[model samples]
Target: MRAMVIEENGGPEVLRPSEVPDPVPGPGEVVVDVTARGVNFIDIYQRSGLYEVPLPFVPGMEAAGVVTAVGEGVEDLSAGQRVGWAMAPGAYAERAAVKASLVVPVPDGVSDEQAAALLLQGMTAHSLTHSVHPVSEGETVLVHAAAGGTGLLLTQLAKARGARVIGTVSTEAKERIAREAGADEVVRYTETPVAEAVRELTGGEGVAAVYDGVGRDTFDAGLASLRPRGVLVLFGQSSGPVAPVDPQRLNAAGSVYLTRPSLAHFVADRQELLGRAGDLFSLLAQGRLDVRIGGRYPLADAGRAHTDLASRRTSGKLLLV
Candidate 1:
């Protein structure tokens, strides 16, 4: 098997492609013949040592593939079954060995590429709109980096729930993408002040909540864009991590609420994992959800994929095929 092995933590260049031994399934595990793998910020974090991992490891966290081998006591899943995982390490390879409990069956209509793309980002978006703050219909919400993968899905999900979504992007191209994803209004944060544009758009009143993934740089603006008592869900820190914040600042910001969530917490068990992924798959099967595969690269080009994603030069999902 060929894998993008990370022998050390550094830049994208650290992801070296090399022929490696195939993964063997342990008890209660299955070795998937990976057809597609999703590239996420977590992969970048792992590659850069921002998020620590043991040395000499594969970098991907999510993938979709066929079960090539099933381990002992794994009855529900079998060889040749189409399955996908939302949270699993060692996925950036031709094959991945994952616990049977963490794998979810992919339906017929959804392709391997779509399943790989949908699991991580799709579930994150679902957890945000459905669980985190629960955006109510007719309420206003703000989404930062709305042109990116999770941002685009969050925008559409928020709109599906009837929330008026206001998205912030750095470029005109991104603004258009956000608008197409059901964003009621798009603010070019690079040209106009995000909070000011948000305030002006709402006629002085602020949004009910802000979905902030671009931490650090947009933290203050997200806090300032909310209405009194509005929530700020800081999910990611693409630019950099946010500094330690004082609780009193929340009080000063009109008693606003702040939270940092992860997909692992929301999908803590197999039931929750399948439920969220099922919802996303159903939406995709019905044509209600459109997952854009922005770029596709062969396994050997994994380093370039990381470079493109880290540079924020691509939109939607980037897949390792």
Candidate 2:
């Protein structure tokens, strides 16, 4: 199998394509003949040493493919079944050996690329809107990087829940994308203060919650963009890791709630994993959700995918095919 392996983390160049041994399924595991793999910011973090992992490891966390082999104790899933998984490491390869618990059935209508693209970002968006803060009807929320993969999905999900969405983007083009995703208001945060813009959009009331994936650069603005007792869900640190926050600051900022949630914690069990993925798949099958795939790289071009993502040059999802 040809895999993207990182012996030491530093930059995008560190992602080297090499021939590696094909994965073998252990007990309760299944080997997938990967057709597509999703490239995410977490992969960048791991490649850059911001999120530490064991050396000489494959870099992807999400992928969709046909099951080639099923290990002992795995009864529900069988060989040749189409499946997808998120938060399962070693996916940047031709085959991925995944725990049966992490694999979710890929519906008939969704393509392998779509399945790979939807699972991680889609479920993250779902968990953020439906669980982290639970957006309510007619309420307003703020989403940072509103044109990115998770951003667009999060915006649409929030709108579906009837929450008014205010999105922040770096360019006018992204503003248009955000609006298309159902954002009620879009602002170029590069030109204006994000908190001030959100406050003005909500008539100075701020929003019910702020879904922030760009940490450090957007942390303070996201916190300040919330109303009294409103929550700030910091799910990623694309810009950089946020510094240690002072709880006193939270008290002063209208008693705002702060949380850093991960997909792993949200889908700790098989039931929760399937539930989230199923909801996203249902929405996709019904044509209610539009997943924009910005780029597709061959396994050999995994390094370029990382470079583009880190530079914020791509919108929607990037996939390895």
Candidate 3:
């Protein structure tokens, strides 16, 4: 099997394409012939040594493919089934041995590429809007990086929940994209202060919640954009990790709530994973949620994908196909 192996943690150049041994299914696992793999910022963090992982590992967390083999004790899923999975490593290769419990059936209307693109980021958006803060009808919420993969999904989901969405982006192109995703207001953060724009959009009453995936650069603005007792869901650190803060700051900021969430914790069991993925697929099949595939690269071009995502020059999802 061909895989992009990270022999040593460094830059995107370190993701060397090499021939690796084919993955075989172990008990409770299934070997998938990957058709598409999702590229994410976490892969960049792992490759850059910001997030620690065992050396000589493949660098992907989500993929969609056909099941080539099924391991013992896996009765519900079988060989030849189409499936997708998230939060499972070794997806940067041609084949990945994913635990059967972690895999979800790719339904009739959704394609492999869409499945791969939506699993990690889609579920993250779902968890953020549905569980983390639970956006309510008529409530206003702020979404940072509204044109990006997760941000676009967050905007749509928040709108679906009937919340007025105020989105932050860096360019006119991104602002258009955010508006298309149903954002009631889009702010070019580079042109104006985000908190000020958000306040003006909300008539100075601040939003009910702020979904912030871009950390450090947008953290304080997100805190300031929230209404009293509003929640700030800091799910990713794309700009960089945030600095330590005093507890007094939260109190001073209208008793705002802060939470750092991960997809792993939200889908902690097979039932939860299936439920979330099923809902996302249903929305996709119904044409309610649009997934934009910004770029597609050959499996060997994993390094280039990382470079594009880190540059923040790309919108929507980047896929290795």
Candidate 4:
């Protein structure tokens, strides 16, 4: 099988396309003939050595495709079933051997590319809006990177949960994208000071919570956008890692609650994983959530995908196939 392998973590060039041995399924595992792989910030961080993986790693975390073979002890899933995962690794290849426990059957109405795009970003949106803050009517929330992959999905999900979403983006193009995703307000952070704009929109009261992913550039501003007892969920460090700050900042900033969340903790068990994937795909199937696959590159073009994501030059979901 052809795979993009990283001998050592660095830039996109470190991801070298090479021919590797075909994956074989072990007990409780399944070999998927991968058709599409999702590009995410974590992939960029892993490739850049920020989020270190052992040397010689495959650089993708999510993908969707056919079940070419099923391992022992796996039932109810057979060869040729279409499936996707939120936590599987080594997906940037022709095939991946994943524990069957982690894979979910793709819904009938969703295409393969859409499945690849939505699995991670959609599930994150689901977990965050449904768990982290659980948006409700008469509540307000702010989403950073509102035009990015997770941001767009989170925007729709928050609105679906009945919260008014105020989103921050870097450009006019992104502003349109955020608005189309159901954000009631969009702030061009590149033009206006995002915090000030958010406060102005909220009548200077602030939001119920801020779901921040643009870490260093937006962390302080995100904290400032929240109301008393609001929560700041900092999930990704897109612009950069936030500097160490005083704990008093949260208290002084309105008794805010801060959480650094990751998908791993949210899908800690098979049941949780299945539940999240289920809800996400169901929403997509039902036309309630839109997982726009914004970009696609061939399997060998994984490097370009990483470059685009890290540079913040792409929006919605990116896929490698």
Using Cα atoms with residue i matched to residue i, what is each candidate's TM-score against the true structure?
0.99, 0.99, 0.99, 0.98
Model 4 bad stretches (over 4 Å): none
Per-residue lDDT tens digits of candidate 3, residues 48-129?
A: 9999999989989999999999999999899899999999999999999999999999999999999999999999999999
Candidates sorted by lDDT, descending order? 3, 1, 2, 4
Model 1, 1-321: lDDT tens digits are 888999999998899988998889999999999999999999999899999999999889999999999999999999989999977898899998999998999999999999999899999999999999999989999999999999999999999999999998988898888898899999988899999999999998899999998899999999999899999999999889999999999999899999999989999988898899999999999999989888999988999999999888689999999
Write down the lDDT that model 2 would get: 0.92
Candidate 3, residue 297: lDDT: 99
For residues 210-286, write the lDDT of model 2, one tens digit per residue.
99999999999998898999999999999999999999999998999999999898999889999999999999999
Give candidate 4's TM-score.
0.98
Q: Which segments of model 3 are wrong by more than 4 Å? A: none
Q: What lDDT tens digits, residue by residue, belong to model 4 across residues 1-321?
A: 789999987888888999999998999999999998999888888888898789898879999999999999999678989999877789989999998988989878888899899888888888889888888887999999999999999999999888999999889999999999999999888789988998899899999989988899999899999999999998889899999989999989988899998888888888898898888878888888888778889988889888888888788989997
Task: Name the better of 3 and 4 by lDDT.
Answer: 3
* Candidate 4 collision pairs: none
